[model samples]
Target: MTPPISRSHPGLRAVFELAEFLDHGQKLPEQSRSLLAQALQECIADGFDTSLFTALGITQWGGVPAVKKIGLLRRDRVLRRLRSRIPEWASLSPNAAAKEMSASFRRYETTRWPRERHSAKGPAAQPNSIWWGLLRSELGVPGEKRLAQILKAEIQDGFEFPKGPATVAGTGEHPENTGTNIR
Candidate 1:
């Protein structure tokens, strides 16, 4: 006879699903959509997913209840990583901040698309590409949000920029280079 799926398996499945969702640049369920959103807020506030996942892998992977417990750990860690990446001046809730960051990143991704690919005669003419173009335009990078990601990543890591922003008309050296605070 075939074996039944263990109760413990669902938790592991959820953890894996959540992790993959993050990897693919999707947002977690909304606070209203999830009872756990409040707790997630605290995890984000604390900034500890990497450590929690480490602990789970090493010591807590036995069953569903344990996995569920670890989900909270992972969620918090995800929130924390996101919060750390955002600048302090934004002063938004962690969830909102994460959503903005995701939107901003999506915009960055869109701008990287080849113009030929997005042209009506190009790959973007496909149904999927068509939807993507629409979504990208909606998430549309405001000058400020784009600048914030560049500055935040630079200031937080003390890392050199991989590439400078695309220059805008008459903007001169990209707005990123003007006497703005990196913070």
Candidate 2:
């Protein structure tokens, strides 16, 4: 028999975090929110069925949920921007888009939360070079392309690509892909 599912998937966690932020009357920082909105749009363009309202546990009336109408509006704005900014994005396959998005998330996470390293003397303090580097890299790809590039890199460096369509399922063991290197 299949094991019981765990809702610990990265995508699910992102959705939950967004939902919790909204629920707590806190606004998502613009950059993070835009990243998420673009990711959703990429999934949609790639023919992946995505319902932000449902993912965030908000009930939809007609088509849009009223509770998070503002966020939905922002998402719609971001979607339009993505379509206009990335001419070839609409033609990308679901698998390809998912792969790109995974890469983007991985990069964003690393930059946003750099790991603290400890030394024999003490914890090594360093400026956020990762975040700065990502910022500089974004200059090469204007608008949404930067996000796409980041997402596409998500599965590199021995990271395993999703075996099927995107879902909030656990990423099973990928012995071949396990490593400390970030690609």
Best TM-score among the predictions, by candidate number? 2
Clashing pairs for model 1 are 8-64, 49-77
Model 2 bad stretches (over 4 Å): 1-67, 87-91, 113-183
Name the 10 consecutive residues with the lowest summed lDDT in model 1: 174-183
Q: What shift in Å separates residue 166 of candidate 2 from its native position after superposition?
A: 26
Judge candidate 1 at residue 108 and give its lDDT: 42
Question: What TM-score does structure 1 among the candidates reach?
Answer: 0.22
- Residue by residue across 95-164, what tens digits does model 2's lDDT show? 4553443455356546543442221121111112222222322321123464444434333222112242
Per-model C-alpha RMSD: 18.4, 18.6
Q: Residue-wise lDDT of candidate 1 within 45-157, one digit each (tens)?
A: 67855343332232244443344444333323323333453465257654456456556545545664444334432132222232233233332222444434443442221
Model 2 lDDT on a 0 to 1 scale: 0.36
Give the TM-score (vs. native) of candidate 2. Answer: 0.23
